[model samples]
Target: MNDGTTTLPWLVIREDDNGNRYRVGRFATRAEAQRTADSLGDHEHQQLYCVERLGARKPGPEQNGTAR
Candidate 1:
């Protein structure tokens, strides 16, 4: 949290010939939300964010919705 004296950490994006990357906003409570939002990756980031992983399913139909 900011105490009216310290600067807040912001989310920023880095772009390269490969693609864009997004960094999530920081822990400061008083920070401006817009500043972080602006740093998020744009459309060019889509391909960069792709990953290979297994899909998990959650229980349903009266069962707890925990992942299986």
Candidate 2:
């Protein structure tokens, strides 16, 4: 059964000057993720930090729907 509950969807992303992107962390709230991004950004001026909301996850084959 689909419980309608999702994992942490807020993402803190770090992008380097060379355009390499990395996932810093995931949070349940945007504020929490942003705070972490801000802290990291403050210490690393050469890197860009940002927060993004992940799209709702689709159900997999193990669940009720077919996997994409």
- Top-scoring candidate (TM-score): 2
lDDT of each: 0.32, 0.68
Q: Distance (Å) between predicted and true CA of 38, model 2?
A: 0.7
Give the Cα error of residue 34 in candidate 1, in Å: 10
**Considering summed lDDT, which 10 consecutive residues are worst modelled in model 2?**
59-68
Clashes of each: 0, 0
In TM-score terms, candidate 2 sits at: 0.69
The residue pairs that clash in candidate 1, if any, are none
Against the hidden reference, what TM-scores do the models get?
Answer: 0.21, 0.69
Model 1 vs truth, CA RMSD: 12.1
Model 2 pairs in collision: none
Query: Which candidate leads the pack in lDDT?
Result: 2
Query: Candidate 2 lDDT, tens digit per residue, 1-68?
Result: 15887679888777687879788899998888877877786663677777777874533435321101
lDDT string, candidate 1, 1-68, tens digits: 35767544432223345655444344343234333343343344432211111132322435321111
